[model samples]
Structures are given as structure tokens and as C-alpha cells.
Target: MIRLRAHHLLCLLTYVGRGYTPAFVAQYSAIVARLNAGEGAVLVEGPDDICAPMLDSGHHCREPRITTRDALAREAVAAALGQSLAPGDTIPLDGPTIARLRENFAAGTIRAACAACQWDGLCSGIAASGFSRTRLSGAPV
Candidate 1:
């Protein structure tokens, strides 16, 4: 269990070796639990990895290019995560819903990626309000 950003989980398959910290395990376990609990996970295919063997594995792959919209969404999520907001925070403890957003960011699937999400509307609304990187440093997303 690694305390990694959602992007790491999207791109990395293996959870490396021993002496894992409790926090790391908790964080990652939460993600796995969410995935196993039937929450939808969006795993966009990396741009250059279109021909990569990992995608060919046919396990958890989708072919979609990342885009500016996705980049904004990912940035927002990162901002929120940086705040380490609890379940009751203004941002709902929406579970591991961010996996796909991270994937979309990596794969260049900006526009069509978030069609299935409740937060899709929010993302657009926020970006429209001039969601800036500086605000990410000042407060949580």
C-alpha cells in the first residue's frame, strides 16, 4: 500500500516491496477497496503507450487521449488531495473516483473523459471560474 497520488496508481501496476508505512497502506487500501466495491474507474490509455504491451494485456485499459480539460481536472484533484480533506470536507469523500481523471490526464482525454461523473459539472464550473494553480497553493480544491 503506497501513499501515492492518483496518477501513480493509474500508471503503476506493482506496489513495490516491504516495510510499508501504515499511512501508505491505509491510503492504497482505501483505493483498492473503492475499486473492488463497484465504483467505476476510468483508466485512459497513455498517448505514447497506445502500442504498449500493458494496454494489450487487456486487463484494465482504455484508449483515450489526454487533453486540457483533463489536465485541469487532475490539477483540481491534486489540489484537493493536498489539503488532505477528510470524508466530511466540502469535497465529498467521493471514493476512488479520481483514478480515471488521472488516467485521462496522462492519456490526453480531456473532453470526453468525465462524461460519467457527478463531478464533471463541477470541474467545468471550477475551471470556468478561473481555477488557478496559485489557488491550489493557498487552499484545497
Candidate 2:
């Protein structure tokens, strides 16, 4: 496996969050191969290839701009929250929080709640309750 930089991971994470298909990896791989073939300074044809590090680093840098910005925002939020984050496997909620979340789910407020929730897409319970695409990445703690 090629060593991925922070920016590369950020790109992949952003695409995953946007609900892109799993085929994205293949596409990125092809782009990487092209980049490795002395085409590092070339440009990609679309936003679909934004997660490619070489593409982002060169003339085809436009597509990855938004992805990069989102990654930065995510990083800032993560820093503010600090490490040792609660895993999505367990939704940590007191009785009141659970009730409120359930109520929100019943009232079609899952989007609002998910927007406010850091766990968002990571939580299977939350995702099943509503909103599928919450966070961008699935890095295990």
C-alpha cells in the first residue's frame, strides 16, 4: 500500500461522507497510477477524482478544494472535541437524551439532531433512526 498523507486521507474521508459509491477507491487508484507515471503535475477530469493526492497536489487541484476545506473543518471540530471519542457502536445518551432523540426521530427531526450530533453517521442506531451520511470517515479509535 502507498503511504497516504493527511490530505489524502482527508480526501477519502470527505468522499465517503458525501455518500459516494465504493467504486471511488478504484477511480482514485487509477488516478494515482496515472500520477505515478510521471503525470504528477497533470489534472483530473472531474470532481470524482478529487481525493487523489497527486491530482490535488498538481494542476488538477480544483476538484479537491472543497473536499480539503471540509476536511479542515472536520479536523478543527475533532480537535475541539479532543480524543477518546465515544464509538458509534454505542450511542451514549442519558434517559432524557435518548427520549429526545427518539422524539426527534418520530418528528422527522433526525436531520437537525444529526447535524448537531458529533456521532451522526457513525452511530448505527442514529443512522437507522434517520440520516445515513453523517461523518466523513470511519477511523477506529
List model 1 lDDT by residue over 3-88, tens digit each: 22233332222222111345444544455454345433333313222213333355233433334334444454545446442212
In candidate 1, position 90 carries an lDDT of 35
Residues 1-141, candidate 2: write the lDDT tens digits: 233322332232223233233454566645444433423221112333444434534443354654453344334323332432221212222333333433444454333212432334444454454433323222122
What candidate 2 gets wrong by more than 4 Å, as runs, is 1-50, 53-71, 83-129, 133-141
Q: What's the TM-score of each model vs. the native?
A: 0.23, 0.24
lDDT of 2 at 50: 40
What stretches of model 1 exceed 4 Å from their correct place? Answer: 1-109, 132-135, 138-141
